[model samples]
Each structure stands twice: as C-alpha cells, then as structure tokens.
Target: MSVPESEELCLDVSGGRSGQGPATWGQQAIWDAVSVLGDDAPRYNVSVGFELPAGRPRAAVLEALTRAARLHESLRTRLLPDGAGGLTQVLDAAGRFPVTVRGCEREDTERAGGQLLGELAALPFDCAGQWPLRIGLVEADGLVRYYAMALSHTAADGGGLRRLARDVVMLLDGVSPERLRELFPATQPLDQAAYQHSERGRKRDAASRKYWCAKLSEGPRGLFPPRGERVRDALFPNAVLHSPALLRAVDHVAAVRGVSGSSVLLAAAARQISLLGRAPEQLLQVVVNNRFLPGMSQTITTLAQEGLFHLRTVDEDFGDLVRRVHMSALGAYRYASYDKRLLDRDIEELRGRLPDLADHSCFFNDTREPELFRPPAGDTEVPPLERAAELTTLAWPVEFPPRKNLSFAMDVVDAPGALELAMTADSALIPRQDMESFLRGIEDAVVGDALATGCV
Candidate 1:
C-alpha cells in the first residue's frame, strides 16, 4: 500500500490542574514491567480507533480533543527521574498536542488509519521528555472519517480508556465540561497520589502486604519444579485457542453455578496447570483492574496490579472448584492495590528462607468485558460439546525472545461468537506440543462439565 499524504494540526491544550508527586502504585507497577522490556517497551502502548459520524466538522473534533486533553491530566503528563533514582509524575497545565491528518481514499480510510496507528505506536515514548498520548486523524474528501490514539500504559488501563472514549463521544455531541463532570466524576492522578501517601492509604498498603506475604509463604515454591538441568530456548512460543464451545459452556456453567465466567475459566486453568505439572497446588499472578473502589471507576489513569491466586486442587468436582475460585478471586482483588516497592522488599525477605519462591511466574489476565458473557436476548440452546468442539481452531501465531521471570502466561479475550485464550510459555519449561494441549484441555474441561450437568 502506498503511504497517504499527511499534514499536522496542533491543538493548544491548557487550563487543567497540574502538579508533581510520587508515582501512584499502578504507575510503579507498570514502570517495573516496562523497564524490564527497555527498547521493546513500546509493545505496552495502548492504541484505539473509532469511525466518525458522516460530515463531522473538523473544528468540533478538535474541540472535543482539546477538552479531553485538558480533562485528563494523564494525557499531558510526563514521567521524569527523581533525584533519588526513582520516577516522579509531572502533569503539565499547558502544552500543544499535534494531530496527524492523513488524506486517504474513502475505501482505504480504515487501512490507512491502522497504518497510522502503527506508525504512532511503533516508537517508544521518552517518558521523561514527552507527553504520554498521541493522536491521528484520517480524512477523506475534506471530511474527518476516523480518529486514532496511542497512549502509554502509564497513563491509563482498559477501564480508563473506555471512560475517556465515552467522554469524547459526549463532548462531540455538545456536552459541557461541567455537565460531563457531573455525569462522570473522576479523581485525577495528582490527587490520587496525595491520598495514597496519606495515613489511610498507608493502612491499606500495610494490610495488602500482610495478605500477600501470607499467601506467598503458604503456597508452593514453584508450580513447575525443575525437571533436571536447565535447557534454555531462544524464544518463547505462543498458542491461541478460539472456541465457541468454551464460551457457551462457560456461560451455562456460570449461570447455573452462580459464579462469574472469569471464575469458571480461572478454575479450569488452575486445574490444567496442576495436572500438567504434577503439583497439588497452583500459584498464579492474576491481573486486577482495581476499579471497584469508590471514585475509581472513572479515573483516567492506570490502576491495575497483580494479585496472587493460590488454589489447591485435589479430586474436587469442577462445580465446587468454581465456587472456591470465585471466593479466592474476591480476596485477591481486595489486596491487589499496594506499594510495589514495599511488596518487593517483603518478598525479598521471604526469599531468604524460601529460595525458590520467586521461581514461579505463571500469570493469568482476563480482558473480556462482562457484557460479552451475558446470554443472548432470547432462549438459545448451547450446542453439545462434541459439535461445538468441531468448530474450534488452534494456531501458533508468533514467538518472542525469552522473557525473564516468565514461565507461563495466559490472556482471555473476546472473539466473534467465541472466547479466545492465548498462551505464551517458555519452551524450556513447556514444549510447544504441551502448550497446545494445555489450551485444548481447558476447553474440554469446561465444555464436558457443562454437558454432563445438562446446564444448557
């Protein structure tokens, strides 16, 4: 495809609260992860695009963009190095944000928008020097057709992005900033940092640390014990399983069992890992959105952190396991917010006695929205496990250079009439064949149980 002609438009954004403070816990957590990737950290960038209404005025779009940039301090913030060898967040009250305007044929608008997204996201942000957000506009026949944005993970999580996107829509429809605030009030990062450093926040941090340390000491040192001398591989292999059967099975099971679909999937994954590694208990670092707290639901900043999930698997039935997982996940989410540095210190101390405590790096992240698991608006029957399994597809998509402190990781995402579970594992620990088996096994476990119970 040929490159489209493009020009730049600058929006002078100002008039938002600005200040400097220590990084929030979420910022610290993401920084730790990104710092490890170094040059590859651009992979953590979050990008999204939307089609514009027909004949939308460019001035209205620009106005909406400018208001949003001012409303969310994260959009105009920079992370600079603190003199003590740490990072500090500095939110600027005024800055000029440049929007790239690409001229493309109407038929190629979407493709060009995607190419523009890639161009904007391909480079790593100079956190200390540049703002955390990038914007692009795709125009055809002198009208704006689509808009795209690339943001640093430090600025927002999935929930934050959704909130910002919703606000932008409202702005385009002529909603006043004051009215928007009334409709969706949120706490900015600077204020959040102030509260986090207060006594109440300290208490929460302490409680979280105690909870995490107890779990760490109680769980097994490693999920997959060292088989023998280490055999290293150059890259980690990734496998994806798209199963409509699993989706229906999970929904049926969740409804009948009175649990969330996420718990059902987590239970199945825990069981599979236990059976594969010959371990009676499994420890996974599950990602927590941390949006349950009051006033946090609409905050436009990153607040996600890892919660330790420790579950023991014996001969228990799948139904019972799902209930237990639901309860355990609640506790994990409760303690998911904490000082990353403090937690690291506590873990380091615990490792003095439990040397292999850090060996386990299994992670589980569920990115599916709750509405996706809701049953269709009518009486629809779930296909049988055998029939549903026939439509399942599995593939190895890509490989990455070996990641440090990573053994196995799985992410749950939405698919058309299906649930997509993607897994990446160290080939040294889990061979490529085993990775395929693990994913398929999860599907079978969920679907077979749903069928056996006649839940459909």
Candidate 2:
C-alpha cells in the first residue's frame, strides 16, 4: 500500500468558559484535560517542559516568558463567559508579567509547580477540568546555569509545547516567530462549538451515537486481570517488547521500502503478538488517530477521530505485514471522515471506538511530539542536554487517569529529535519486572541492529 503526502489540516476551537477546579486528581485530571476549551483539550493536553543553562546572560529566559505572554492571549487574560456555552478570553490588563524566576536548589521546580498548582485550585480556567499545568525551575550551579519550563497539557500538545520552547530560544537571541495568523486557518473552536450546537451538529451527534451502539453489539470481554491494590501510578501493561534494533531496522528498511512509521510499528506489533503465542485467527484491536482531516490542526480543539484497527496474529512476513498495516491505516484515515452520524445512518448496531477488548493490548504510535515535528527557528540554539541536567530539574508527575485499556503516552523532549514513550496499564495485568524485561528486549533489539550494520 502507498501512503500519500500529508496535507495540512485545521481544527475548530472555542475560546472556552471559565470554570472552577475539581476536588481530586483521580478522574478530574482527565476530565479537565479533555474538556479544556481555549483550544483542543482532549487531544493536545500532555506536555513536558525543559530547563536550560545560560552561558553568559541569564535574562534571556525571563525575556522569553515575557514574549510568550505578549503573543498568546489566553496566557494574559484568564477566562469568563456568558451563561450559555459562548466564551470570553481576557488578557490581563496589567502588562504581561514574566512568569520565570531563578532559584538556588533543585526543589525550585517543585516550588514553582506548587504555586501554579495552587493557582489551578483557586482560579477558573477557560476549560473545565483542566487545572494549571506547569513545571518549576531552579539554578543550583549559580554561574551561567540552566533552567526548565513545564506547561499544562491543555494549552498545547507536545508539538505546540516544543514550538513555544523554540520561540523562547529565539527571543533570547532577539528573534520573533513568523506571525501564525497568516498560515492559520479560520476553523476556531468557537466555530466548532457553534456548529456543535446547531441542528446539523445535533443530527450528526445523534447519528454518531447510533453508529456506536450498533458497532459494539457484544458485552465487554478481555484477558486483563483486575486491580487489587490502590495503584500509585497509571496502568501497567504486560511485557511487550518492541525491539529498538527492530524499530531502527524497520525504519531503515522503510527508507528503501517506501512506507511510513505507522506501517513499521503495526507490522512489528502484529508479529510480536503472534510470537507471544496468540493464534493466527485471534482478533487484535488497534487505535488509529484522525488528526490529518481537513481543518484539524491549529484549532485549539480535540479533533481526533478514533477507530479500531483489527489485525490477526497470522502467517505474514515483516514486509507483507508493513504493507498490510499501511493499507489499514490509510483505510481508517479515510473512513473517519463520516463521524459517527454517518455510520448510524449507513449501518445498524455498529461499534464505537473502544479500548482493546480482544485479548490484545493497544499499539498506538503518536510520534508528533518528537523534536523532528518542530524545526529550530529564529536562529534559536537549543542548549545541550548535559547543560540542562547541570541545573536543578523537578518532574512533578501529573497523574491523568487511564483513557484506554492501556496507553502509550509518547512525549517529546525540547531537543531537536528526542522522544519519551510511556506505556501505562493496569498493575494487575503486568508487574514491574515484566515491564523491565520487555524494555530490556527492546534495548537488545536496538543493540542488535547496531551490531549487524552501523545504524543507530
């Protein structure tokens, strides 16, 4: 199967209504993150911020924050809205204040984070459920040290967050981003909300409901074990090894084979499941994202259309598998355009997108957050990772409830091309050692690739 060139898309986003914070973190975090209004909350909410070292000047960081305030209106004014669904964004009348400050210890990250978290508790954010998401920074080394930034998932997705970091670097060097107003499409969340409330949108919503009901005709059935203890972190998926070497090799092969990242991952997953002793006829479910639709990107709104990708752990070679996965992805991408409304109208008792229930764990690869997505602009230089570590770094982990049966949260680092992939699952289903072993296999696979041929 051949993949076509990607076309830029837009999404409709609304300004958002001001709302109070929730009482607890458990489900509230997910609810808030998903419902965030200023832009797309559900799809773009997860983020990671970086702290970097300064060579001679320390003021650039502060300058960058100031610039951010000036550029984005939501950062300036909080939110207020009419009793109806419409929203009003208020930029703080007082000149935009720089939110960054230097601290002496590693705990500075915690200090800043606590303050912001407190703000989320008290203030009403534009979107409901999404509280303040931020990271703290501290300069322990004193002389020309590094700092970091943590933003909430609601404001931007990993890609948007990285873009903002590049902007900061540019400001330090006296550069500004290309005005986005020109390239940006007109599909704001506000437009989507208006459409969502319309008679047409209502009809669409109803059709979508019927489509889901028909799609999922059977009761729930999965092989996952139940949780007995109060889990501290998120889900714990069973050991599933995606060899780094195999991953690399597949990519190398794809360059010569002319396929995509999704093709390689899917093919590999199908093989892995088969290797795990699943019968060839067994059904395996996969999650597919629909971000490439017309007017999906840039709209601060959740625009993903979820669809299940069913595969079998049957007889197939790696190349054949890659081709199959590519074809499946393209098919799903096209099929998602109708929304649930059309499905209901066309088919009876069709199933809606749900978690993996076919005795198989989900394999989702959203590499959008990787450094490759956002190029270095405005002559901004990203400080070395080593420099960042020299400074104090605090990771106040945000525990967003598990949405799928098991999730793979792929977060991108601020650096040009790095990614952090996190897989969460129910603890009862997988133990820590098992998880470690699975990772070890991937490491081995990556190492194996390097040994066979000088390839990273």
Candidate 3:
C-alpha cells in the first residue's frame, strides 16, 4: 500500500459564548502530567475514528463538525500562562480548526484512516496557542468514507470524547441544535471552573487533601526497596499479558461475589505487590473517572484524577480481600477530586518530616466500562478455566524512558474475549522476572479463585 498524499483544510467554527477562567481541576491535573512528560506529551492525546456512511456529503460532515465545535467550549479553548505560574483557559467565540484530507481508494480507506489518526495524534498540541481538537478525513470515490480526530487531554477524557462523538453523529443525522441541546445538555468548562473555584469547592478540595495526606502518612512508604544498582536492560520495561481465562474468571467471580471485576483484579495485583515487597500494607494510586459527580455526566472536559488506595493486607480469602477492595475503592473515589497544586504543597510539607514519603509510587488504571463486567445473556456459559488459560500469551511490547517517581504501574484494558494487563516497572526495583510474575500472578490469582469457589 502506497502512502496517500494529504492536504490541509479548515472548518470555520464560531458562535459560543467567549469567556476565560482558571483551569478546572481536571485540566490542571492533566497539565501537571503533561509538564512532567514534556516531549512525550503527545502520548496523552486521545484518538478516535468513525466510518461515514456511503455517499455521505463532505459539506454535511463539515457542518456537523462546526456545530460540535461550537457546542463544546472545551474544543475551542486554549490554555495560557496566568503570570503567577498558573494556567488560564481562554475560550474563543470563533476560530478555524484544521482538518487533514486524504484521497484514497475504497479498499484503502481503513489503512488511510488509521494512518491519518496516527499522524494527527503524533504531534503535541500547542495548548497556549492552538485549539485542542484536530480532525482528519479520508475520502473515497468523491465521498467521505472515514473521519478521525485527536483531542488534547486538557480538553477531554474518555467520557468527554464519547459525548463529543455522540453529539456529532446526532448533528450529522440532521438533528437540530436546539433539540440536541434539550436531549443532551452539556456543562461547559467555564461553568466547571467557576464551581471548582467557589467556596464550596474549596471545602471539598480541603477535605480531599486531608484524606490523601492522612493515607499517605499511614500507608506503606515504598512498594519495593531500592536496588543498589540497575540490573535490567532498560530503565523502564513494559510488558503485556493477554489472558482469556482471567476474563472469564473475573466475570464469574464478579457475578458470584456481587463485586466489580475491577475489584477482583485490583485485589489480585495488591496481593502480588505485598508479597514482593514483604509489606503488610499496600498503597496504590488508582485513576478515578469523576463522571459520577452531579452535573458532570455530560460535561465535555477532562475530569479524571488519581485516588489513593490504601490496603491493609491480612490473612484472608480472596473473596474477603475483594470485598475490602470494593469498600476501599468507594472511599478512594469519593476523595479523588481536589486541587493538585494544593495537594503537592501538602505532600512537600509532610516530606520534611518523613523523607521517604515520596518513595511510594505504584499506580493502577482500569479503562473498562462498567457494563462490560455484567452477566451475559441467558444460556451463555463461560468456558472452562483450563481451556481459556491455554490460550494466554505474554509479550514485551516496548520500553520507555524513566518516569519520575514510578516504581510500578499497571493498566487494565479490554481485549477480544480476554483481558489485557499492561505493566511498566522500574527495572532496578522490579526486574523483568518480577514483572512477568506480577502480570501472570494477577491472572492466576483470579482464575484459581473462580475455580476453587466453583463460580465457573
């Protein structure tokens, strides 16, 4: 397949209330991460693609996009320095958003669309100057076949992306803007900023910080003791394990135990980490999606932040541990939202007394939707655990430069009839052997529990 030539175009979007305000908590959280990443900031961009109907008019698609950009203020917002080492979001009433167009054969639309999405996502957004949204279109036989987009994390998270995609599709189907607003009224970023800076918001922030600091002071100071020297081939090694048995086992356990699949997986991971570190307590930074809060379900902005998970390990069965995890998770989610700047200050102040306080650096993120863990429809039977386990595979995909204060990080993502666990660990603290064991242990722990409990 030859590379398709591309041309740049612009869609003129206008007519939203122009305003400026301090960045919302979500924006600030992502901005802090991006600042740490620096040149790797593009890795935070969210990309999505849609296949357009045959014979879809380019003009109609452009119009729908224009309406979507106008409807979501985050799409038109830019971040600028506020002179006091802070960020201010500036929402413009009108601007031109660039769109990359590629003409390709019908058979090549999929490849072209994937390529376009990668190209669009590879570049870092100029958050201070450029709008946070980028678009690309693949045309075949004089009609639009596919469209791809890359959104800056400062503007949207996974939930926000879904809402934006839904609104654009509705608009493309000829829904009027007024009716669309009535159907899915969205809370703008400016509204969120206002509420977050209000007195009530300050109280919530303070409470969150207090909860976090308290946990930090009480939980394990480090997950792994530092090695005197590096031993692995890379500073940060990334590994992925795809396990179908783990998926089936997790589903069955979730159904029987009346807990979430995520809780099961989190408990398993915590167990392995405690065994490795020989610690009676485990502390993990769990990413929380804050859409459950009031007025945030349909908000078109980033609202994810890390919640502190502190687990005191005891001699208990896996089911009991899972229940404890479920309860602990509720508390973590409740205290997840706060001002990152204030929390940093609190941590710094505490570090003066407890020097090793900053050594605890383990993170867990589960990206699966809630509905995915539900019981299947009638007559659907889970396969035998041994049979599914036979198909498990492990691979070392990539290595990354050292991430600051990171010892171990685990991410759970959905795979076809399976669960994919990706891990990145500091090689000095956790060698490749331990990394493999950690990933495999999660699968084994879940599967073994399901079989032992006769859940499958």
lDDT tens per residue, model 1, 8-104: 8778888977889988888877877888887799999887777775746778888998999888888888888777657799999898776898888
Residue 312 miss distance in model 1 (angstroms): 2.1
The Cα error of candidate 2 at residue 287, in Å, is 6.2
Q: What is the lDDT of candidate 1?
A: 0.83
Best candidate according to lDDT: 3
Which of candidates 2 and 3 is the stronger one according to TM-score?
A: 3
The lDDT values for all models are: 0.83, 0.40, 0.85
Model 2 misplacement above 4 A: 1-47, 51-63, 73-100, 105-147, 177-188, 191-247, 277-291, 295-306, 312-315, 334-421, 426-456
Per-prediction CA RMSD (Å): 3.0, 11.6, 3.1
> TM-scores across all candidates?
0.92, 0.56, 0.92
> Of the pair 2 and 3, which is ahead by lDDT?
3
Query: Over all chains combined, what TM-score does candidate 2 have?
Result: 0.56
- Against the true structure, candidate 3 reaches a TM-score of 0.92
| Model 2 Cα lDDT, one tens digit per residue, 1-456 | 222122221211233233222111112223334454444342343434444534324445554555544554333333334355333433232332213334444445444434433432333333432223333234444532443444444344444445556555566666663444344442443344446556876575565444334334332244334424645655434333322233334445456446775555555544543443333432333333334545545443234444445453343445565667677666545433233333433443232344432443444554443223542334544343333222322232443454544523222122232222344444554345533443443333323333344443
